[model samples]
Target: MYQLKTKETENSVIEFIENVEQPKKREDAYRLLDIFSETTGYPAKMWGPSIIGFGSYHYKYATGHEGDAPLVGFSPRKAKISLYFATGDTAREALLEQLGKHTAGKGCVYINKVADINEDILKELIQQSVQFLKETYPAEE
Candidate 1:
């Protein structure tokens, strides 16, 4: 019975941003909060102690592990910011190609700062990720 640790919390997103060690990262956190909220049509919520997530969806794996996760989220880490998105989205690779200076992991896009990436491309990635999750999981009404 493995439990997901990143469930949404009622903690303040504003306070989280304000506590960021770097001033620039704090500013970028606010900027991203606006971007993700506007794009996902959902208000920001704290995921665990760090991640600022917008929307959420429940996913059940083939192994029967199930958990709810954010549709799109970002964390301002000490080294770089981590952008979380759906894994195996068919359009993701193409969008990442157009995205400027960012490094990719299985499901996280790491960026040095807000200025290092193109805003339009980031929005597209957010939209695509949200769409893919909605289509794949189809949240219960």
Candidate 2:
């Protein structure tokens, strides 16, 4: 059994952001917190030590691996801010194309600062990700 390291925790998202070494990154985190919250219509929660996540869905893979994950999240890292969104959403690729300046990984989009990208596109990405996850893994009552 593999345990996910990034499981949601009770840590303070505000404290985490306030502790960011860069004042600008700290400010960007606050901006992202608002964006993700308003876009997803869900309040933020801490995932692991760094991630500020909004909304969540449980997923079980074909291989029997399963876990709950945030619908969308972001981490203000040292080098660049990493944005977390749904990986399998086809719309994500298209949105990434429209997103201004950023680099992406398996499931994280890296941006130097909030000013480096378009907030509207980021909001669209967040909305699409939440919709995709809700459809893919509808929440249980």
Candidate 3:
């Protein structure tokens, strides 16, 4: 059984951002906190030690692996800020094309700063991620 390293914690998101070493990264973190919160319509939560996440959905894979993950999240790493969005969403690729300056990884998008990308497109990615996850892994009511 594989355990996920990044699980949601009770840590304060603001506190985490304040502790970020780089002044620019710290400032960007705060800006991202607001953007993610307003865009997702859900409050921010600390995921693992660094990721600031909003909204969550449980997923079970065909191989029987199951876990809960945030619908969208970001981490202000020293090298680059990582944006976490739904990998299954086809629209993500199209949005990223218009997302300005950013690098896409296997599961995360890396940006130097928020200004390097379009906030409106970022919000769309967040919205589409949440919608795709909810639809793909519909929560049990």
Instruction: Identify the runs in model 2 with alpha carbons over 4 angstroms from their true place.
Output: none
TM-score of each: 0.97, 0.97, 0.97
Q: For candidate 1, what's the RMSD?
A: 0.8
Cα RMSD (Å) between model 3 and the true structure?
Answer: 0.8
Model 2 poorest 10 in a row by lDDT: 1-10
- Candidate 2 similarity to native, TM-score: 0.97
Q: Which window of 10 residues has the lowest lDDT sum in candidate 1? A: 1-10
Across 1-141, the per-residue lDDT of candidate 3 in tens digits comes to: 688988999999999999999999999999999999998899999989989999899999999999988999999999999999999677999999999999999899999998899999999999999999999999998
* lDDT value, candidate 1, whole model: 0.93
TM-score of 1: 0.97
Q: Give residue 138's error in model 2 in angstroms.
A: 1.5
lDDT of 2 by residue, 38-116 (tens): 8888989999988999988999999999998999999999999999999987899999999999999999999999998
Model 3, total clashes: 0
